[model samples]
Target: MKLQDILTPDCTICAVPAASKKRILEFLSSLAAEKLVNHDTFQLLESLVKRERMGSTGIGNGIAIPHGRLINATKPIAVLITTEQAINFDAIDHRPVDIFIALFVPEEECQNHLCTLQSIATIFRDKQFCKQVRQCKSNHELFQLIQQAS
Candidate 1:
């Protein structure tokens, strides 16, 4: 799915004030709930955190893509956050992640999930594009940036 389809204006946050992995996940989950995602935000956070335990989703360059699959979901959703301070993610590049793009996909949508991830990853690979997202300071601006990418 396109980032624009899943990323709502409310889902895009600028300057998350979290400093650790758990805090980051909690912050993101709260955004999902505030966005009216149809699930227990804390449970979703736990699943995503478990996934992270298996392996860090931090893709380097001050970015982290924490994601998970859920049985209750029928579609995918994205939550974007730019932290006020960088947090350690145990990334391959060994860098702190400041920009986070979390995804939640339905258990039945494996192929779609991979495609969505590929699309997000490609969009993120463009350092300039990622820089633009990082530069956004408001929810409206962040949604616009994501829309432009799609």
Candidate 2:
């Protein structure tokens, strides 16, 4: 699946003031919860947190792909965020992260999950694309940048 398939303009946030990794996850969870009917914010936070316990999703280059599986989810949902300042996320490269892309997928779709993650990673690997994402000053511009990506 493509990012546009799961991500909406409303789910993309820019210049967020979250100061810590936990707070970033909380913000993402709450944003995602707004779009997910009947989903609990606490439960969504738990899912993302549970995955982080296994390993940091912080993939370095100031980016983190925090994702989780939801048993009750019917389709994947993605939330993109750009922080006003970088925060420690336990990245492999040991650098702070400022860009976050949180994903929630149906628990049963393992293959789809992997594919989606791979797609996101591939896009993020482009330094120019990431630079543009970081340069965006508003939510609409950020969402447009992601949607217009190749």
Candidate 3:
């Protein structure tokens, strides 16, 4: 699927000041909650936290794709956040992470969730795309960059 298919303009954040992984997930959970119905923000955060406890989603090169499956979710949801400064995320490369793309998917849609994660990883793996995303000055620009990259 497409990034735009799951990401909404309202969920795109630029220059966020989240200093820790917990705070980042909290912010993303709240953002994803806007598009969900009958889902608690704490529950969403718990799902993401649980996944992170299993392993860090930080895929190196200043990017982190944190995702979790939710039983209450009817469809996939994405939230993109670009922090004002890089934060330590226990990344495999031991590099700070400044770009985050979070996904919340239905528990039953494992294949689709994996595909979406792969697509996002592929997009961010492009050095040019990462550079463009880093240069984005606003949420609109960041969202547009994702569109262009896709």
Candidate 4:
């Protein structure tokens, strides 16, 4: 699956003002909920939190991909956010995170979920892509950057 297939401009945010990891997750959870058939933010948030308990999704270099699987989800949904300021995220590199691309996939789509994660992780690994994303000034700009990058 492609990142563009799952993520829409409507689900991206630039310069999001969040102070902590929980707040960031809550915000992304809200975005994910908007696309869910059940519209249950709490359930999605719980799944994300549970995943974090197992291990942080922060792969380093100022990025984090907090993700989870929802049993009732009909398909995958993704949200991208750039925080106004970096926040500690327990990243492997111990650096604060400013970029977050969160995902919620249907529980049954294991292969698709893995591929999507791999795609996102690969994209974020590009220093130039990460730099361009950080330079975005608005959600519209961020959305355009993602489209252009793809």
Clashes of each: 0, 0, 0, 0
> How large is the C-alpha RMSD of every model relative to the true structure?
1.4, 0.6, 0.8, 0.9
| Worst 10-residue lDDT window, candidate 4 | 32-41
State the lDDT of candidate 2 residue by residue for 27-141, as single tens digits.
9999999999868789899999999999999999999999999987988899999999999999989999999999999999999999999999999999999999999989999
In order of appearance, the predictions have TM-scores of: 0.93, 0.98, 0.97, 0.97
Whole-model lDDT, model 2: 0.94
Candidate 4 structure, TM-score to reference? 0.97
Worst ten-residue run, lDDT, model 2? 34-43
The residue-level lDDT of candidate 1 at 34 comes to: 61
- What TM-score does model 3 achieve against the real structure? 0.97
Question: Native-vs-model 1 lDDT?
Answer: 0.85
User: What lDDT tens digits, residue by residue, belong to model 1 across residues 63-131?
Assistant: 888998887776788899998889898987999999899998888899988888888888899999978
Question: Could you tell which candidate, 3 or 4, scores higher by lDDT?
Answer: 4
lDDT (10s digit) by residue, model 3, range 1-150: 767788888999899997799999999999998788968889889989999999999999999999999996789999999999999999999999999999999999999998899999988889988888888899998887787675
Q: Which scores greater on TM-score, model 2 or model 3?
A: 2
Off by over 4 Å in 4: none
